[model samples]
Target: MPDSPRLHRAKAGRFVTFQFMPSLNQLLAAHAPLLVLDAASTRIQVGWLAPGSAHWAASFAEAGIGLFECLDQLQTRPEAAGAFVFCDGPGSILGVRTVAMMLRAWLVLRSRPVFAYHSLLLLAHARRDPALTVIADARRDSWHCAAIGAPLRRVPTAELPVRLAMPEGFRTWSTAPADLERIPYSLAELLPATHDADIFRAIDEPDAFLHEEPSYATWSPQIHRAP
Candidate 1:
């Protein structure tokens, strides 16, 4: 019998890097090479970049798990290294943090390399050129959103500032606490199609922040809770 071909064996020295940057374009442009674990609600998308080629991974996270919680495949596969996680945020603040904790623990249990990303930016990367507004629709609190355009304006949780800035003909949608779907599209529009330049960035779980971020990044829009 012939030896079966495997990715781990096929490509050695390939490290799975977890890049938690605020901007996808920055990440992708910076890293000349890598693979990406672009996970989100109900789906985990993967993509790879080799020498001169760029392709997306058709394989994604399991069906039943929450966004960014897909680790089953990484655990089973004998890849060069463990998987990396780029978490998004803005709505599920605590849930986003919990997922990080979960990823770290999972990595420790499986001996994998884990990384982080500003969860909110994932959507920002997906939809670019919209007035990026993060609707902070928490169960118990009022709603809030922020504009990412020039002269960045942080919308008041109690009142969406666009209402006042918009011309008479321009329309702005209101995000109620119960309305989750309405806002995702709005959020997606702001994200520019992008990712880290080098998909693989070696990183360890963080216990606390040690220094100021060199770039302008906001940890926003967490949609779920860590349970």
Candidate 2:
């Protein structure tokens, strides 16, 4: 699939991109029997979204083991699903990457459309609170911030709002801001409210979300001389 052109903005020493996604209802309508995976937090959530009803399974173990556990509980094979949905980031990088790697391997066996969504964006859409500022630790004294109607950005911790909502089970390195709200990050809890919310986007390749594409500078060989 061709890459979709996305709008990007530079903020807090990173380039952020605005992603648009379709809702749960929309996904079910078009692609029933969908297999959804979310390992963006401490919990590993797996769901089988079919017409009329959906089944959710979860595990709290480490990503590598927990993912398979949840999948086993669901008991649905990859080929049986019409399409696949995955949470792309703003949470556990290793967990997110684990899910992405599994999805890529599954794609090798059988090709299907895969969709991606940001963890904070999903929570924002589910909560439907205009004043709710969703945040996740971005390390280096910065955080990933998302609101109902704004693009996601990396903001310095000192600049964060007095009150903020963080998804449950997100790991934070710095001191949490005052008046921080911990919201449910489970798919079973969050997905119910997002039935009509547009928060999923189709992705050709699956990978953990990065604020900017990594770049490396070329080095040339030269004779060294001491001054």
Candidate 3:
């Protein structure tokens, strides 16, 4: 990206590989890269963390943030050597185009490698024997859902029903979106601010399916009883 600090690639650079079916863990040896955002129909989440720090810096707002912002903000704000972004799909013809433009923009703005992965796949990547069904309500009287078993297939959010609930076999894990609402970082504090900030905000998307939130961060085996 444009504001990047120059550094040569690590000669011994390698990525940690983990098996997703049963659990997810990175190789302790892998350096942490800045994880940009999870733009979804329900909520927009942003975060970054220092490699191996185990601590997280995060924020949350409305969904569709990707459709508006230049995306270089993710690179510029945190100033990471590399960036990874996860987004729901298959978006409109315009959404797909946005992804393409954003990737190129990040490359130029950050002067580093920028990668885009399907948000569902990234989420599913952490699941062992992951069965992901991209569901979203089309409104009207009809809705759509696409169930997938990863390593088996990839599903897009637009094609799925927005309000559709997940199956029983799956577990949930998300940094509380509400927690992000509490950290009041102003737009002026965003380093390089944007005038067209509406896209990254929330939307009135599909909400046709039925699902429940499973306990993620707050639950513990010792203190919480399983239903």
Best by lDDT: 2
lDDT string for model 2 (1-227, tens) is 12344433233433223355667776665566789899988988999988778898899999889988987998877789878889999899999999999999999998776888899988998888888899999988999999988888999988997658999999999788888999989887788888787778788899999989999999999999999
Better of 2 and 3 by TM-score: 2
Instruction: Identify the runs in model 2 with alpha carbons over 4 angstroms from their true place.
Output: 1-20, 221-227
- Tens digits of per-residue lDDT, candidate 3, 142-227, equal 22333334221323333332323332212224221121112122212221222111112111121211223446676556766789
lDDT of each: 0.37, 0.84, 0.32
Can you write out model 1's per-residue Cα lDDT over 1-227, one digit (the tens) per residue? 12233212213544323223223443333342333443333234444433444444323234224333323433322143324434443333434454556556656655554444433333433444355454443233434343333222234456553422111111224434232333242212222344432222346663211123458778889889899
Off by over 4 Å in 3: 1-9, 12-31, 54-78, 88-103, 122-132, 137-227
The CA lDDT at 80 in model 2 is 90
Sort the predicted structures by lDDT, highest score first.
2, 1, 3
Clash pairs, candidate 2, are 21-200, 22-200
lDDT of the structure predicted as candidate 2: 0.84
Ranking by TM-score: 2, 1, 3
TM-score result, candidate 1: 0.44
- RMSD over all Cα atoms, model 1: 13.1
Error of 3 at 147 (Å): 4.6
